[model samples]
Target: MTPADMPSVNARAGAAVEALRAASTELKIGVARGTSGETVIDAGGREVGSIAAGVKIAEICMGGLGDVRLIASTATPRWPWTVQVHSAHPVVACLASQYAGWRLAHGEGKGAFFALGSGPARALARKEALFEELGYRDSADTATLVLEAPRPPPAEVVERVARDCGIAPERLNIVFAATQSMAGGVQVVARVLEVALHKAHELKFPLERIVEGMGAAPLPPPHPDFVTAMGRTNDAIIYAGRVHLYVSGAAADARELAERLPSTGSRDYGRPFADVFRHYKGDFYAIDPMLFSPAQVVVTALESGESFHAGQVNLDLLDASFT
Candidate 1:
């Protein structure tokens, strides 16, 4: 081929080199030696390159990852976020309150919203420094549980005290104290006795004799429906096991102590004085540890109208006292 007709080597090579340099700069490539000779490849910052043997350096330099360009469209966009703290315990509630307190102290946002009546709620209220001194805006507080009834500290009261403190009666959230006895004990054991009677019947024992043995003597012909209803609730998760029993009472020497009773499918009838204690440990989360023996906790879970089966337990509602 004539020199004039053939492409000019220097001009073609120069043009190719210039094009490569422009593309390499855009790709942020660095010079590196490969099979044929030195060539331009990936920048070697965050990416690596592989080339075929005998290939010319110019050929390998021809391709690279495209430049990354950030596009600008909207100047500002709105983003919204929210938070929730779900807890029935005073301690956990307290932690959430402190978190809110920190946010308020910083004045980070427009305003703070919170659910009141967790232990933390009371703790936050008690912080006179925040409200009285610093003047933090008070957030609305809602009571989770409240109760009202007319009764003196008990007929056996020595001195009377006002139920309401500095807090307004309307603002005050109240929960009933389980009845206290003359001995300062509230024994809710009648249900346990009734359960045992029903179980005795299922075990093929005489229902009448079992009922008579369980305090039927005092009442003049007690309602049979009461016994039947008790039996049904017991059967339907009021107790564990097809034949589970719950024994409880603070009476130190009750003849029907749990320890003396036979073992149940879901309980340890010895050592712990109540079947509820056994249930509490077996299904810990289903019962509040602070208010019940693991056993009592379990019993409460069973007594809970909610349905639960083996290996599944409820998230637990704290006893009114704790929450």
Candidate 2:
């Protein structure tokens, strides 16, 4: 038998599955590094292919909301803010880009980094400059705040940015070392927290209470953010194991959207998912109420050729990310 067909490979795969199960509670999202044309997400922190950067960002956005967004255009669309993902590691740029778009839609303000290699210091400067170009003030005290992550800014670099942004070091909330993956992007997670805080305050709620709800004992209820939903959709399309498809923006009119989806495709019975609804959009899928995570929902749809739709509601459920 070939080496791959040996017991060792199966053992390793089994171990990886166990690890994934063990860490599933802590890991809400993960980026799939395509291995041998097969994408397998593991929780043990190893297996399949390189996990790469941006998994933290994906997890945060997905946990916060049911979907994520993509740039969806050749040129940068006019937006309120922009965050550029700098890949200190060259090969992970695509994964990083996927993460960045997903995070941005979740109201964290993110953009994609074109160059990938060493020299994050230089890359960060460019990101800051892009933020300025998007009309955000250089100062942190301004209405808009810029956040970076997964990588720490050196003391000098931090000092320089603080000075330029007119903010003190204490104002900076850098989760330098991630509680999960040591090399994972805590800074990005911190930024997501920062946005959540801003959202909580805007909703006239306590940030601590919101966080508590997210990390409660039995695992918090599904609090889907529209922005996060858009981001998650993008991620679902990209790293999904089977089919990849387009997703609508949270703002799309429901009836109008319904009219657009072409109802055509052979309905397959006995799909492994909760509910396999047929979409006129050429055989779309919807999730059963049982599936909580957007990633899972998307994965199920991709595998089963089903399209996802939120009944005829006003999308009010997507409050967190929409506003």
> Can you write out model 2's per-residue Cα lDDT over 79-134, one digit (the tens) per residue?
21212222111111111111232111111234322111111111122242322222
| Candidate 1 residue lDDT tens string, 176-253 | 111121100100111222233333333333221210111100001111232222222222222211112222222221
lDDT to native, each model: 0.21, 0.24
Best by TM-score: 2
TM-score of each: 0.17, 0.23
Q: In model 2, what is the error at residue 215, expressed in angstroms?
A: 19
Poorest stretch of ten by lDDT in candidate 1: 214-223
Instruction: Compute the lDDT for candidate 2.
Output: 0.24
Model 2 misplaced stretches (Cα beyond 4 Å): 1-151, 177-323
